[model samples]
Every structure is written in C-alpha cells, then in structure tokens.
Target: MKKRTMRWASAGLVLSLFLASLSFVPSGSGNASAATSKSMAALYAQIQNERAAKVVALVNKERAAAGLKPLTVHTNLSKMAKDKAIDMFKNKYFSHTSPLYGSPFDMMDAYNITYRYAGENIAKGQKSAEEVVEDWMNSPGHKANMMNANYNLIGVGYYNGYWVQEFIGK
Candidate 1:
C-alpha cells in the first residue's frame, strides 16, 4: 500500500511539473511576437549603423593615404543615404539613380542637404565594409568619388546587402 501511494504521489508531482512548464512556454501570441519583431528591427538597425561607421573610417583612411582631408559625416546626408539603402533593399533595385528618388542629387534635395558638389556610390551583396570599400577602390568611378579632394563630407549607409555612400562638398 505504501509503494502504491508513493507511485501516485510521484505521478502527481510529474503532472504538476508538466503543468508548470507549460506556463513558462511562450504563447506565441500577437503581442509577444510584435514586441520581439520590434526589438529585432532596432538591433538590426544598430548593426547597420555600426557597419556604416566602419565604412566611413575605412574611407577616411584611404583619403588620408591619398593626402586628402578626411570627410566629415553629415547627419542629413547619413539620413538620406540610409533611406536610399533601405529603399533599394525593399524595392529590389540597385543604382545611383533610384526608382523612388530619381538620382542621388534628387535624394539630397529631398532631404534638404545643401552641397556645392555631390556624388554617390552604391553597391549590393558585398559581405563586409572592407570588402565593399575594396571593391569600390578597384572600380575607376567609385575610386574617383572616394579619392576626390573636393568632397569634404560623407555619409555611409548599409542595410542587409545594400550599401550607399554619399559624398558632398560645400
């Protein structure tokens, strides 16, 4: 009889533990999912921002080697570049001229970025900041934009697999 009672008690304890585990399990409801999504988006944006900053530093190092002044990051231009990067990623297009924003100049104008000279470089599918910068350095046109002594301001944006670098002189 004592063994029988012990077996029943153990079964009850196991059942209680199972029930308690269910309460700890995620419900996968709309609210919890939405919160998770929001946090993930914010974290992704932060990572992209860090990548963009690295691009700026690498570009500056190249400019320094070329005896050119380091370009300062402009907040307005950064915002514009980020918008362009996101737009290209979402719209599945890649170019200096965007379907939504026409040209880089048009994007700057839309963003109210004043500049005497402006240039933009866009790339897709490059894995890291160094790889993208190296690719741009190897290209004649992109190298021109990066090496141009006239440009004193820069904005870099990276999102998913897209990158945009905006150069401005004022």
Candidate 2:
C-alpha cells in the first residue's frame, strides 16, 4: 500500500511539472502573431475609421434619396441643414426651451432622423473632446439640473440597418 501511494504521488508530481513546463515554453509554431493589445493611438485610429465609415454610409443613403451619386460626407454640412438639425435634436428629443450648449451630435437618413453620434458632444466653442463634455456638464445651472433630472444625455446613431453608439465617460 505504501509503495502504491508513493507511485501515485510521483505520477502527480510529474503531471504538475509537465503542465508548468508547457506554460513556460514558447509556442512551437515558427511565426509570431500580432500583439494582442493596441496602443492608445492605435485604438483611437481604429475608432476614427469606424466612425468615418458610419458617416459615409449615412451620407450615401441621403444622396441616394436625392437621386445623386454617392459623395463623401464632411463636417461642412450646409448651415441651414445643420441649424435645422440642431433645433430638431433639442426640441424633438429633449424638449428644451432654452438653447442647448452641447448635446450629442447626430446624422439622419432620409426616411427619418434615425442616426446620432452617440457619446460625442456638440459644444459650440469647445475644442477638445474633454472640454466639450466637461464644459457642458459644469455649465451654469446645468450640473444642478442634470443631477436633479438623474439622466445624462447621449446620442444614438445608426448605420447599415443597425444602431451604433459609443460609450463615453460621464
């Protein structure tokens, strides 16, 4: 019985060592793979590309509706359309009486207003993303109002028959 116990213990030790050795050794495959994680710049670039693609799709849909060829979408949307858009966003969505400084920006297809910029803010004069979000939050009376209302505003955009939105810090 003692001899049998010793054998079993030895076998267990051998199995554990084999597993530990396997983890320490590099893969047998000759080729190395891309890094599993990306830098902040890479991540931002990827997101920018994704966002641009969505914008393009929405713009193309609008052009098709107008019987025009597909063209690239730019930030330089006509002032009339842009102003009307900002108004529709505030009045129809939030029912705000006063002009909103910044809420999320959005684009809509021809059928109706179906797309938004999700978490992106539309602060008129704020330059950076941080300022756009923070300035709006800390604006005079906004903090108190938002805290009382218990809801942070965000945009909801869509692309290619699917809803797309990004999460931004509150």
Candidate 3:
C-alpha cells in the first residue's frame, strides 16, 4: 500500500510539473496555437516530401548496421509506421505504447501535438515509416520538451548500467 501510494504521488508530481511547464505559454495568446500549427505543418511536409522507396532503402541499411533482418519497404506510410512501432517495441528501444497506451489522440495530447490520419488532411503521399519517425524525432518543440520532462522518468534508472524495468524482466 505504501509503495503504491508513493508511486501515485510521484506520478502526480510529474504531472504537475508537466502542466506547470505549459503555463509558460502566455494566457489568451494565439502564438501557442499558431506555433503548434506550424510545427504540424512542417511534420506533414516532411512526411509528404520523403520518398517511400528511399525510406525503405534507408531502413534496410539501418537494419544491416544493426544486424537485423530488413523489412520490406511498402509505399504505404500508415502501414510502415505501425510496423515500425511494433518493431521498436520488440527491440525494447522506445515505445509510444510504453508512455501512454490508451488512445492515439490521448498520446498526441500528452505530446502536445496534432495527429491526423494519413488521408484526413495534409499527409496524402505515402512515406516510409522510418522516415516519418525520423521527422518526428527531429522535431524541435514538443519532442524535445517531452524527452526532457514527461518521459524522462522512463529514461532514468536505466542509466548507470541498470535495467529500470527489471520487474518486468529481461
């Protein structure tokens, strides 16, 4: 009971810090909204501009470097993203699911970004999953802040040559 309480307390503290960080955005200012839109547009453009064939080749090259089997590059961006997410989870590298598993919208909200289905609005062309991921990782604002603050807990305890998720086992 005490351990559970401590865990909940820590979670609440982290959440409070996360919310407080948002207060840096001026009240009733449109810049926050506009900045988000611009970031999303950049992401959309990056995804659209990336060639699926080139992305596939890049992924295959990366796999060879990692000594893993190459994935078949498909011209389907959505499918590629899904497969990459699964593969990353399998590798225990990084996981969107690990942070928040409820829904995509919720996850996007936590990350403070807009997410749209490929056919919904801006993203129409198919890009390789790896390319899309690279774009997101390279994004300036939300991605950086999230890594620095909210998700840092998951990253800690893994440093200093220790397995943080030891309870889950290797």
Best by lDDT: 1
What would the per-residue lDDT of candidate 2 be over residues 53-81, giving only the tens digit for each residue? Answer: 54445434543565545443333232223
Better of 1 and 2 by lDDT: 1
Candidate 3, residue 146: how far the Cα is off, in Å: 42
Q: Give lDDT tens digits, candidate 3, residues 50-125.
A: 4433444543454456555544322233333343344344554553333433333343344443323211101112
Q: In order, what lDDT does every prediction score?
A: 0.92, 0.38, 0.37
Off by over 4 Å in 2: 1-38, 73-170
After superposing candidate 1 on the true structure, give the runs of residues whose Cα lies further than 4 Å from its correct spot.
1-32
Ranking by TM-score: 1, 3, 2
- Name the Cα RMSD for model 3: 18.8
Instruction: Find the 10 residues in a row with the least total lDDT in model 1.
Output: 22-31
Candidate 2's TM-score reads 0.23
lDDT of 1 at 95: 77
lDDT of 2: 0.38
Ranked by lDDT from best down, the candidates are 1, 2, 3
